[model samples]
Target chain A: MALLEVTNLSITFGGLRAVDNFNLTMEKGELYGLIGPNGAGKTTVFNLLTGVYKADEGLIKLDGLDITGHRTAEIDRDGIARTFQNIRLFKDLPVIDNVKVGLHNQFNYSTAESMLHCGRYHKVEKEMDEEAMKLLGVFDLDKERDYLSANLPYGKQRKLEIARAMATKPKLLLLDEPAAGMNPNETAELMETIQLIRDKFDMTILLIEHDMKLVSGICEKLTVLNFGRILAHGDTKDVLANPEVIKAYIGE
Target chain B: MRKTQKKTLITYAIVIIAYIILEIFMKAGMMSSHLKGLLVPMVYYAIAAVALNLCVGILGELSLGHAGFMCVGAFSSAIVSQLLSGAIPDALRFILALIIGVVISALFGMLIGIPVLRLNGDYLAIVTLAFGEIIKNILNSIYLGVDSAGVHLSLKSQMALGLADDGKVLINGAMGITGTPQDSNFTIAIVVLLISLFIVQNMIDSRDGRAIMSIRDNRIASESVGINITKYKMTGFVVSAAIAGAAGVLFSHNIATMQATSQYFGYNVSIMILVYVVLGGIGNIRGSVIAACILYLLPELLRGLNKYRMLIYSIVLIVMMIINWSPALRDKRDKLRKKLMKGAGHGAA
Candidate 1:
């Protein structure tokens, strides 16, 4: 069974069909890439999947569970975690806490316990710190764990966000233009991290990107979106070579 | 973790040292009775400021109805203490009142938070502002008494209550509750303040605190990461309200008479508490404490200035703002501190 299945997903903003008849299926541990030109509604599709936007008509199933129209947190608990196109780390909180917030549901302590610092609070907090530190280690953010997330340099901020998302322990991870503003060197490093993450965590990944290098290097399957419609869908090499997909990217 | 622990310890130390010094001054007869009278109010105001900071700074919600929570605490606890005066021992009665106050206000917090939190920014602020005034007005018009006939409540005149001969009026409309037991003292107020500090600081360092703050930072990201936004927001808001209620308990118990009035539990008081939160450096709990103490005492201390009192206060407020927030002023202060440290090092050498 597919980890995530979206059938006939569509949304409209007034008369404009922002995302129309979008269908996607990802098998367990598949690395999928979604690429498109500007205004291609790629992020809109991610929003629909994450429950940031309610789909006008669609069926979203996660791990055989019908999760259509569930709220973002509900969908996340049902096993889908995502990073934003514009990096959204808890800016005022420390780097470790950003991940610890992601680790929130996995741990347990009541409001009273947290307030009074009694009961299971100490043990749970220590465990959270350890788990967060280990995740930070994976992203090489351990050295900067105590720094406020807003203070980190751009590349590291992106990595911290991904680490925070990964901390949620989701089965399906969505990366919306994870390498959006990176130069070649950082983009290459990010590509390696993405592959490493898939292998290490056995994650089913879907990412939107304009960076062809990172996309071609890491994505096994590709789906091209243009003006809210799928232009091509196949293995990465075949989809990229398709004349229609190429035309949407460069020009006719 | 160690850094935060040390910082919290410093905050505790500051409160403790201030308490000790004030005690010494009082024992030495250096404090006027007027100054002594101001002590409990100052502490409670500081406590209220800390509570407001929890909501405004940490939860990232602007609540203009904090004084309403305080008002709820004050009245409910006062009534409980009054009714239970002889049934429970005095200390125990006060403790029960405090607990009841916190719990009742927390309930009010959750009730108000449910609908109010759905709105954001200015809308939330406006609604809370209305709620605060509404609470005060409702309390003002209530007349409550108890007798062998169970309990009597009236929105009309006290005569309408038609209580039994031995009936005791707990709350009189407009006049408010008179003869509330003066169970609160400076020491008790300070102790409550310390507990508030402990709860807020500990919660901020814990996992749930991180979740609440994450919502404050970004709602969408927090939700995507499986942090329940509504639950955490309510948690922060309600806890903050409960603490404000504790301060209210202190307030009612310290006063000879507790009244629901614009002077005490109005929008102005809420805004004043907010000023403490902002001037103390919002999200800085210790800063709230210090700001509340100094700002609350300033006008009282300058009463001798008479006509110039408020004028001086306006200047102080402006100075505090610049000192705390102005980038240029902060840079200069930082440089000065660094130089002072360098000079101290040279002297040691």
Candidate 2:
């Protein structure tokens, strides 16, 4: 069985079909790419899958469980985590606290424990902080833990988002436009970070990126979307070689 | 683990020593009466201000009827304490009275928060303002004053629900409760203030507090996160309402002639409490406490201005807003603040 499945999923906003009849399937441990020209509904699929927008039509199942309408926090707890297309870090929070916010899902202390600073609270907080620091270390962001997320350089902010999402301990990680405003050097560094994190964390990743070079380099499987529909899907080379995707990009 | 635990233990030891010293000074006459008096309004208003902070700052919802909740707390405690002047132990009686006050106010909060928490902006302001008036009218309709029998007969009775002695307040209508016992003191007030501070601080730092901010920052984002915005908003509302209620009890019980005449728990009181939060730079707990002190003192400072005091205050508030919101000035202030904290943190380290 597929690890994640979307069947005929459609979402509309009062006459504007933001996403229509979207469908895909993913295997466990796959690193996949989703690509489209601007306004091609790539990000909308992410929104729908993450439960930001309700699907007006069709089904989304993650590991045999229907997640079409799970709450975003619930979705995160259920082994699925995603970064936003536009960076949505809790901009004012310290980088460590931003990651801690993700770890809020994993906390097991009571209010009483916190108030009295009980043994359980301290123990849980210590364990969680160490785990969060380990995640940050993977992204080479442990040094910047005290910095406010908004103050980070553009590339570091993207890394912070990934570091944050990883704190959720997701089984399937989704990164949206992770290399948006990077120079080649930063993008090249990001490529290694993403691959390293995938290997270290042992999680499947689905990414939507505009940079074709990054897409072609990292993705083993790919899906191409256009105007609310899937234009192509399958192995990265086949999806890229598909006539419809070629036509869509050529016409653009 | 070894180094950090040792450092934290030393830090905690210092904090405990400081706390003990402060408590000793407070209990002794080491602090001046003027400072003590100043702290009275500070603690009282802080209780109400934190509630306002929850509704106005954290939940990012507006309510102009906060004073009405305070009114509920004050009267509830006043009546209970007055009626029970001889029935219970000195300490336990007062505790019961305060509890009654908090519970009553929480009920009022739940009643108001259910409908009003959903309304945002000016619409919420109007609803809350009207709710305050309705409470005032209801209070006014049931008078409590000296009667022909020389017994205090208020429109409402001090009698516990069904306990008898319909001695009359709603058992007399708008004369208002007279001859009520005034038993609240600095000790009681400060203890309540500390509890209020503890609750407000805990809520602010907890996941629930973050959830409240999440609700304010982005409604859709918060809901998508399974935050149950309504529950968290109501939590802030009720907790704040209960604190305000406790303040009301303390106020009514503190002063013998605590009057709610004309505009007692009126719009101005609500605005005054809200100003405490806004002036402190919304969302800053320490800032709220400071704001309460300065704003409470502003009126006394205006005593020399006599009639012009309010005018000066109004101007000061407006000028403060101009200074605060100007991007360039705010950025400069942030830089200065960060520099100071860095210096302080380093020194502490």
Candidate 2 regions exceeding 4 Å error are A112-119, B1-39, B114-127, B142-173, B214-228, B257-262, B318-349
Candidate 2: clashing residue pairs, number: 22
For each candidate in turn, give its C-alpha RMSD to the true structure in angstroms: 1.8, 5.1
TM-score of chain A for the candidates in order shown: 0.99, 0.95
* Cα lDDT of model 1 by residue, A1-252, tens digit: 888898999999999999989989999999999999999999999999999999999899999999988999998899899999999989999899899999989999998898889999989889999999999999999999889999999999999999988998999999999988888889988988898898889889999998888888889999999999988898999999999988988998
Taking all chains together, the TM-score of candidate 1 against the true structure is 0.97
lDDT tens readout by residue for model 1, B96-211: 99999999999999988898776656566777789889999999999999999999999998999999999999999899999999999999999999999999999998878888
lDDT of 2 by residue, B1-349 (tens): 4433443344335434544675688799797666556555556787788778877877778878888888888777877776677887868887898899999999988988788676554566787788777886777655443223544433444442233344334222344555556566555666776667666665655555666766676565444434566777778778878888988887776665555544568778898888888877676555666577677878776777898998998888887776666789889998998899899999999
Q: Which pairs of residues clash in candidate 1, taking residues 3 or more apart in a chain or in different chains?
A: none
lDDT of 2 at A37: 80
